[model samples]
Target: MKKLMISVVAAALVLTMAGCGSKDSGGTKVKFATDAAYAPMEYMDKDKVAGFDIDFLAEVMKEAGLAYSVTNTGWDTMLTSVQQGKEYQAGISSVSITDERKQTYDYTAPYFESTNMILVKEGSPIKSALDLKDKKVAVQISTTADTLMTKIMGGDNKSLKRMDNNTLALMELESNGVDAVVADIAIIREYVKNNPNKKFVSIADAKNFESEYYGILLPKGSDLKAKLDPAIKKVIENGKYATVYKKWFGQEPDTKKLLDQK
Candidate 1:
């Protein structure tokens, strides 16, 4: 009887440990968070979440043998949520990998790169960044461009207005509430594509605009990075990332060395 009881206890311990080591029932499911409203990156399509980053993630996840789901959170919320180890395991929004972000969270190899650009209504007086001095400029709050604008305008540009999202900022530009908007070049592309009536153009030959590289944001110390980096390198080397780029952005990756330089 004593021997039988000890055997039962050992079996129970083994079973408990096995359960602890098992993956979530979602079956390799990874929680991917993005700003969902950023179309051509991640957004709602016919009640289904789909976009460039979503499609790219689907392919990458398959290549990595992982299953995943996406959550459409606000941009700033997505970043902070992942850092706090909330529901999401990774962030796939077109998030630029920067030294500042690195101080908070780890990032995967860049999947997309772009320069900062200005979007203004056709025939607008704001021909370049310099032309906008003392003029009202709009940007998404807490974005790289927001900080850059602050620096460009010389100390505090109290006239600068902040919006919660890109769409709103762009809308303000349309209504003449702001002189122009500073946004990612890729984002500007999609916006222009959808809003043909707007006849938009980039500020020609603008300096002080920073090029940025988008990366998959992962929680610091997460094992997911180990699986992600090599797989990303695979896509880059096998010409897969470029192929995906043409499908969504209507252009190929610019091999020119961009940002990430000192």
Candidate 2:
């Protein structure tokens, strides 16, 4: 009888240990990394992170019945932290979904569309892509804007000034350090809206600029994508996405058009 009791207790302990191991996977918490410097997408609001992406993800997590935490990992290391270091389960920092990135990282369905724009001070002569020839331009290094600018004006051009982030690039343009700043249209528009004193205008090259889609970054073969992609679709289908869209952008999103973009 003593041996039977011991075996039963041992089985109970094994069951307990198994339960503990599965706790986190049972939809309790997910940790995420993000670069909170990109406004209207993700940015620091005092000690807290706030923005369109933050709010959208919050809603998605709520719908999926999971608690989450976000760490403000800088843009340069955000992808590496998830893909190689395995530091976080996923990342969402307006990361563009490109063919190159797909090889190394898994991504949720594209959530946002973006395009490059050339931002110039109120009276700058750089009105178009052609006008940027031999003119000093500021852009965040390794960004889509940098890629586009390099293609427009050769990589050897001495006029290209690469900065670490969009804010710095815009600041350089404002200070007359560069003739113009090339960055995402949404980011430049948000900055200009908030800083009325610093008059900045964005010009788009309709024929030259290619639109890119943004997606959440996950480790290759991550099961998190299965959870997130469906949640994203649910948010769009239930009108929650439109509410968040209007809150940040001051207008409703073109639901049909954006959803159809792939």
Candidate 3:
């Protein structure tokens, strides 16, 4: 009887260990982080997260057979949060892929192409980049737009107004707190489209503004990149990418034009 009881206890222990292992390996659940203040890319629609990147990533995750959840983190901390793995595994907030950032994070292939644009109140007389000289330009802090503005207008230029997010920067422009806002062209266009009463106009200078490519960001050497990269390519090849692009931008993606730009 003693031997039988010992054998039963051993079997129970094996079962418990197996159950724990199964739970850990049962499914792929990636925690995704984003700053939802940038519309048409990733933004809060009502109480839920919805936008181009959200929809596009949902398809990519499905293709990769991974379950995922998104958390709205502050833009300043979003990248670091993914890098630290304290709260998220990946970030996708129209994050531009740049050599400087590559050292800190692994990124999926370029998912979207973007360019900088100058936004001004309608009939404000700021028709082009030259008009921005000595103007108070508002930009989201730490974004590529801010970097561009600092480079163009000088870092210590008192005309530069840094805001926490693009929406706030636009508000500053509407209230005449700033003469203009410099930001991603798609973001500016989306904002103007959604707020018909706001009276905003955008100016693009292809010669002056370099096009940027956005990608999904993960911690350095993250295995999620292996799964996500292939899925991104598959979506582009299968028309799903264009479908999502059209849903958000109101026109089908010119795949050849976008891919060739890189």
Best-matching candidate per TM-score: 2
| Pairs of residues clashing in candidate 3 | none
Residues 173-260 of candidate 2 have per-residue lDDT tens digits of: 8789999988887788898889888777879887788777888889999988888888888898899999999999998887776678
User: CA lDDT, every prediction?
Assistant: 0.69, 0.75, 0.76
Off by over 4 Å in 3: 1-26, 260-262
What's the alpha carbon RMSD for model 2?
Answer: 12.7
The TM-score values for the models, in the order shown, are 0.82, 0.87, 0.85
**What does candidate 3's lDDT look like per residue over 1-262, in tens digits?**
0000001111111000001111232475677877676777877777677789888888887788777777776465566677787667888888888877877788888889888899888888777776787899998877777777778889999899987677798899888999999888888888888888977788998877888888888898888888888888888889999999999898877677655543
Number of the candidate with higher lDDT, 1 or 2: 2
- Name model 2 segments beyond 4 Å from true: 1-27
What's the TM for model 3?
A: 0.85
What's model 2's TM-score? 0.87
True-structure RMSD for candidate 3: 13.2
Least well predicted 10-residue stretch by lDDT in candidate 2: 1-10
lDDT tens digits by residue: candidate 1, 1-262 = 0000001111111000001112233465677767666777777676566777776776677667666777666565666667876677888877877776777788887777666778887788777777767888888777777777777675467678777677898999888898888877767878888888778876743467756777888888888888877777776667777788788888777644422322
User: Each model's RMSD to truth, in Å?
Assistant: 12.7, 12.7, 13.2
